[model samples]
Target chain A: MSEVTAPMAGKVIDVKVNVGDTVSEDDELIILEAMKMEMPLVAPTSGTVKEIKCKKGDSVGADDVLVVIE
Target chain B: MLDMVMTTGVVHLTVGNLIMWLIAFFFIYLAITKNYEPLLLVPIGFGILIVNLPLTYLMQEGEGLLWKFYHYGLEWEVIPPLIFLGLGALTDFGPMIANPKTLILGAGAQFGVYVAFFGALILGFKIPEACSIGIIGGADGPTTIFTTVHLAPHLLGATAVAAYSYMSLVPIIQPPIMRLLTTEKERKIKMRQLRPVSKKEKILFPLVTVMVICLIVPASAPLMAMFMLGNLFKECGVVKRLSDAASNELMNIVTILLGISVGATMSAEHFLKPEVILVFIMGLIAFAFSTAAGILLAKFMNLFFKEKINPLIGSAGVSAVPMAARVSQVVGSKADPKNYLLMHAMGPNVAGVIGTVVAAGVFIALAG
Candidate 1:
């Protein structure tokens, strides 16, 4: 399993995928809002979604694990 | 002995002086307690308090402390340009470079400036004074002061204060107008992310801007040249020290002198007039109109572009820097919490600075 980390400090504004969902590489997985801009975090590799460590309206720090896929 | 004691400054204080003190205290209160532009209003409030103290001579023509600061810094047109230098160093032009069309929105925001000019004229102000008063709509403090110094020196205090005050009020003033002009669907429109800007493009931007802007409006050279130069210092990667000094140390030093000198200009004799009230009223109108014009222009542009532009970001063209842009983010997010417009709004926000400088240059060329 591999964890996807947030690129910057911001609030998690949306979670686009659920645990156990199959995803393709570069498919948008989460939307992080920081510096007043929304950044879409994408899947790093195609895999079945394992877990989502964040939720909508969650404040996150840089490098925080947002999702885990296997 | 009795006459000598009676001649002290306390004996000369009038009701006018007391009223001016109250006004000064009000500004101080806002700065300290309400957290409204404390850096500017605190010094400005103290300057007003001291200047109105019967006969402190703080603003005496040739010798008073603030008079010297005002004459050398403002009258000689030094502080505003230096302030521009600092702003340039502090600014990030990458967003603007990534999206050039926002520059048009910046220029479009000046709609309020011209509107106010004619508005002031109809109210019976002379051309020069009207020009100074009208520029307050730009929501740029230094530009307002620069133009006022050139076009209408007497109106400097009222115009400068109006500009700064309205700038702080951007959050409060822009929301209603943004909501009024844009539909909820328009506010929720998500813009494509800005492309990453190259270092070469960043370095080239200031050079090209100075050449084009100065050639067209030579009167803008003082502020524009310094502005571009500061940006170059920041972008070049070779002049870190110069950039740091310009944006930090020098900027802070100039701000203190600028705030106090601007405040000293607002003595009761000059500030307590019916026309001064009119200037304030017109300034508010200018800000509202500028905000509306920007949003309208964005909606108009949406008709042509295949990729839609979020109209809410357009109100940021008022040039209050991050504050106006933040207002766009706040208002846009309210429509849809997931919509983020701050980075996109920054394009028009920075562009508004350039637009105001150009407008000021045109005014100087025409009136000065």
Candidate 2:
């Protein structure tokens, strides 16, 4: 499965799923706050999480593969 | 006994009317061809066509359909509040919430509003007239009309037309100033990522801000309340119908009335004055300064932050709404396909809208 990445650089405000959670396409898994706005990082496809690269309060960049769904 | 006659009423439409028609035609053409803010310009252009025909009963002392709409819809202050409702519906407060610092950029963008207001005062306009004209710098349509009708009723025509006309030309007016102020290297700067905000935070923000802003500037309460209310509806996730109306049918109806009313303000006697020229020139200056202010503020922020901010997004802080925000992103993407600054720019972009409303309140308080 492909990695779901961040759309922009921002602080990780929240991670909706714990490690080992199953997800599907368009399921919001993370919230990144940029420009004083909350942008959700939705799963690109259905997958089981193999990794969660960041946590709450972590900063991330665009296309930084946020979660690995296997 | 003898009767002398000018050209037949229909044929009496002279070269001046023809020239005005050409102006309307060009505005329509630009709006259609260039894909600028056509939603506004196309209607305003059509209004120019209808009203500028010398002896047309459209704007005579009696009831003309448009004149009736203009008098009741805009003059009585009906459409602006509703337009604000629509705007509030469409506005996303996320960027402002996520990057609270961008509010500074929004505040900075209002420098032009005051600067232009002062410019108008120095040009012999009275305080109220100056205030209305000055708001053109905010780059917002309803704010321009609201301030003008309330403060300097006479200059309403020039101020409104200039505000909308320049808005439709933002893509053209902003780029040159952006180029003039920044080096290509600076334009290409990649900004740091923003923090995440919870849905709870999103839901609470508008509520808290309403108290803060309305308390600070009571005159701003109407526009600000309408604005925050729209965001509230959008965020609460329970009132989808209200959000849909605010963004669509309500906004569309208000826009139609607002555009024509503002366009109706542009009559030859009112629009052909030397002050009108001043309004136009001050508009360009206001746009340039707002862009500069946004860039400079972002540059200032870069000193404390580890990852540099893309200063280009600062230029979007003027209240051109999503257009300015989109421009920031497009400019960034041109430098690096990987870069997307639209949402980042929107933080200040939306903030600029509120800031301008606050600034308008300041003017109304002082000028009134």
Candidate 3:
């Protein structure tokens, strides 16, 4: 399983994928808002989404697991 | 009893002083309750309150406390540059270095500065006064104060307050203009991820920029040299303590002195004028025009580049630092939640600082 992590501390503004959704490398999976800017977090590898750990408006920290792709 | 009462400051208070007190209270209220530039507005509001009180001797030349802060700190041109030093240490030039084209947007935002200059002149202001007023569009407090000190010292208080106030209002002021100038499609444009910048490039950025910019505008050296030095201290990895001090301790100390001194300068006699009102009006115009100019420039640039740029980030070129960049991010995301424009916006945001400093140098060279 590949876990997607936030690059910075921010509030999750969008979760673009659900469990069982397949995503390609570099596909945007979530959007995090930090320092008043929205940052899109992308998938690291091609895989089926195994877990969605965060939802919209959830505050997250740097390196926090946001999603898991298997 | 009458003689003693006459000696008290109360006897000398006039409607003007009373009105100034109300203004000061309003500033304090905004800072404390609304959190608008509180670090600056609180001291500034108190300074206004104390100075407006007659016979306080707070601003009396050579003898008063705030007067000394104003004279040596500002008139000698010391504090603003020090503020620049702190800003440099605190800034991350990585985004800007990774994308040099944003520098043009920084320069493009200065369109409002020149536009305001002519606007002021058309309204009967002298060239020096007009120059001071024009720079408020740059949305940089230090640059506005520094430029006003050199070109029109008398307008310093009004111009400084205008610059800082407008800076705090950036989130509100910019979104409308950004929306007005950009189409929904343009706002939704997604930019490619910025390449990771190397430490070597980061270290060399301040060096190359200082040399190129200062050589072209020698008058900008005071602020620019210290600014570059601070950034060097941060990037060099050898002087973390110095970098820490510049961005933290020294910055806080000077900010206190600078804010209070600037605030005291707005004695009722100096501040309550028809022209002062006009300066505020012109300041708003400058800010709006600059925002429009930056967004328009980005749209204009998109015409040729294969990799399209989101025009919303263009409004970040006004140099309100993270605030203007944040406005761009917020506005851009409103168009598409999946789009992240914060880092991209920072390029022009930081570039706007350099652009404003250079523009101020040009003004000083021509009018000072």
Shift in Å, residue B11, candidate 1: 0.8
Off by over 4 Å in 2: A1-70, B1-8, B11-15
| Full-model lDDT, candidate 3 | 0.91
lDDT score at residue A14, model 2, on the 0-100 scale: 96
Sequence-dependent TM-score of model 3 = 0.90
Candidate number that wins on TM-score, 1 or 3 = 3
lDDT per residue for candidate 2 within B116-169, as digits (tens), equals 888878988888988887889889889888888889877877788788777767
lDDT of each: 0.90, 0.80, 0.91
Residue lDDT tens for model 3, B132-174: 9999999999999999989888898899999999999999999
lDDT of 2 at A26: 71
Chain A TM-score of each candidate structure, as shown: 0.97, 0.91, 0.95
- Candidate 1 chain B, poorest ten consecutive residues by summed lDDT: B332-341
Which has the higher TM-score value, candidate number 2 or candidate number 3? 3
What TM-score against the true fold does each predicted structure earn? 0.88, 0.82, 0.90
